[model samples]
Target: MDVKYQVFISSTYNDLKEERQEVIKVVLQMGHIPVSMEFFSAADEDQWSLIKGLLDECDYYVVIIGGIYGSIEEKSGKSYTQLEYEYAVEKGIPVIGILNRDVNRLSAEKRERKKVNQEKLAGFSELVKRKMCQFWSTPSDLASNVATSLHKLMNKNPRLGWTRVLPKEHPIEEIVQTVNVDIPKPKNVVSNGILTERDIRKVLKKGLFDFGSFIDIYFIIEGLYSHSNTETKLPNSQLEWIRKNEIPAHLQQVKEIWTRSYRCIYTFINIRDLAQKRGVPQDVISIGNIFISYIYYVLTEVWGDVPYFNNKPELEMAPKGSSNVKEIRTLSLANLQSVLHDSTLSTQHVDLAVGVAVRWELQAKNYSKAKEYIDKLINRDRYKLAPVHEIFSTDVESIGYFDTDQEGSQFHNPVFRVLCKKGRFVHYLRYTEVLLMATEIYFHLSDHQKALYYINLVRIRNNQPQLKETGNNFIATLLDDWKANLGMEGSYFSALKRNGYAEKVLGIPAFKSVLPIPAQEIALNPNMQQNEGY
Candidate 1:
């Protein structure tokens, strides 16, 4: 497949506007996406989050330092340009730093006047020099140098750039048949006439199966989960959704089915009442509660403060009022706990409930509760760590693999390699994650020996040298291991945030920590409140 990389163009706006334009044009000529801060206002306190997210998505970062210090972020006391560069560096995005060969030759309008800014500019220039550096005297020189540097970078380290998936070849008759076929109405929707236990089972199976079929769910979750890893932070925008072309359509498909699935669950509740009247077992109703709790957790985590349908599934079409994220998570955990305790709960659901409980507790920062679920997962003998060699196997299920479709192509996790279309076996939970969580829990409780013991399990399993008990900076060592193991799997960034390394490691402001509710969501729902940060 032909790949088109996203190349971020970073520079002091006013001074290097011409240079940036040249670089953007070059990137376009190279058939790559050129991202910049043109659409964002640097004065905005939360712009860093958006900028950081943009950089995260970009395959290459091009930093052009002219004379100006650029717009400084008040919180970090660093220019947004510098912040962007540092974040890209922190995330290990390949950078092409171009500096003005002689800033003294620049016109008065292009040079920094403040002594402090000049000092900062000099320091920043030196910092960029530590990486891939190219000197330029003019916009054209900058463009030429950028083109050369980008070519070298592309040749040296190939990134998983974006590519359009073309339609597969089919027989002429197949094409004709497809063209003649009428579009089918959605399946798995709970109809208005589901009055029996059989009907409930049919709808539940069909609806949940249909809900699960949207490969888009994996994509959307991967994109949104970027917030947790140092990938994408803050609420996503219409632009972000558009930039990721597949997102909007899949998102719509998911929402449509997701809403229908909710309607089905509500339909199930009514059937439960009928079943109660008939003296039939309410096992399905209990099972439905497990799914509902999971649904609430997913919605709240992905989009904070979503419209929750509690007692009224009929209001599915009505405008949804926003529900508090904390409340939803708390309720999901409580419901999961209640469901897990039921005598009729099956072995399969017990596993599912424990997994959900672990995630919810982790989100809640209730490490103790998270540890309990994790312990149950460990002791149940339902899963075991794969041998070190099999951990990266595309077909292996021993270590971790959710939704392992035979048709689905797999790639190494981006953390270990370059970003690509088939980035890793997109997994939700892993045996290593469980071990790491145990490590974190023990570390939290000040049990150094236990923490080391748990963390070493992962390292030893992977055939890597283990961290010694005598090693200094155990937390740092553990953090490095956690990041390496889970990078790009949708958990590293959240891990950083949860472990208090986000502000320090991510270098983001405090307010940016909480994702801003996407503006489009608020616009669509007048009742939705924006998060604290813009």
Candidate 2:
């Protein structure tokens, strides 16, 4: 039998209205039907019954504890929210609690009530010996923790029963231990006495120079180079030989670098500074810088050109591609956009910047702005650039040029029509697609006029006739038409997400629509925060 799980939100209405809303938003984002008291009138007994039934039917329960507990008498003494939580626990449902850290600083009466609630919760935890509940300090934290917990719960087979149920004591540690089993070490370990060809082969076979292990290898090399023990030191001649020609020539030399140099073990910041002071070229530092920058561009959506090392200035620079640096002295949003619009600029360079800008705007939720840039690419007559698909999707291998009959298929004799005939220029993102995105954003923001305008613009560009309007219902009609025509082009997901229409159409929350922040960012910046419901 196959069944979808429901999540019921239990919270004190008086104290946690905002938090409850947040949780509901998260639930909706997660594609689950959220059951809460706000959906009903204050005095509706039928609503109360429905809520209880929802609680009973729900596969997971989220109990939000705020500053004050609602009076059972006011409807008051203990809250219906607390009672629902108790009921959920009694029914053996998976329950998680979100408690604000500020609860400790409440008024005396409220504090006393909070204490009682805390005692009751503690007693329940002790009695049940279940690690089902967790606390979060902030709304964002609550959302993230809930998402993570729910994801773990969902991935495990329910048939596994209580084994998958997390216990409260050292919960994170337990989760980690479960996920990563200890690998026993080999009894016969090799000492670092001699650099055997076999040892070199083993290390090289592991592809140990990738970004992940580069730092570890660098540190190991550094330890070998900077040995302080005179008894175990190599001669100056050997040290000089290693310094000049230690790293294998076959290793991929540094291609590009970013601003982050501290992470590179071979690139010592202080040593580089000293070298600069002595007016000497630091080849190792330069290589490390270029490699890191290339990695940064590949991993993150950073706007502007791929940074290059400027030998004269001795700094990483984003020089305008194939243009005189003196003429394009400064870089700004307008400058970048103008460069993208210019027909003279290399299409590859323009498209590179455009792609980065598109991603940046999408992340910042500036869909209209993103579309404007995209429009320039698709409507190349207005700007001198070629149509987006002509430039970006021109790769013969990508569209399978040789896979079909030469006379029957468009892919058979495909030719590059955008920017230049030479294979150097390619369009990364197109204008029509951006317009589609803008339309979706406008629809989501409930600005029907803008949505219709952008959608009709695309239709006109595609040689489609203007859609006929039937009074106020015209917008909905046009929306349906757009979906029918452009739905298969990857616009459906964005439209549903931006409009908050996913809950009704796909039975999922909008929170699930967003991508999570890179885990590395979280590790680096403790103050940096994750998105809600992610």
**Which run of 10 residues does model 1 get worst, by summed lDDT?**
175-184
Q: Tens digit of lDDT per residue, candidate 2, span 1-534?
A: 222346677766655666677776776566444556563433334334545555665678777766555544245344555667777778878777666556667555445355686775444334333555566676678777777777676666242111111112222222222211221122211234342333222222122123323322222222222221122333322232222222211111110122222223222222233334445433323332333332333223211122222232322222222222222122223334544555544454455456445544554467677666555444544333224245333442121111112212111112111101223322122344456555655654567777777777766655677654335555355445545443322234444433445445544454434323322222222333444543
- Which tens-of-lDDT digit does each residue in 140-166 have in candidate 1? 988899999999999898998765332
Q: Which candidate has the highest TM-score of all?
A: 1
Scored by CA lDDT, what does every candidate get?
A: 0.62, 0.42
After superposition on all CA atoms, how large is the RMSD of candidate 1?
15.3
TM-score of each model, paired residue for residue: 0.52, 0.28
Model 2 vs. true fold: TM: 0.28
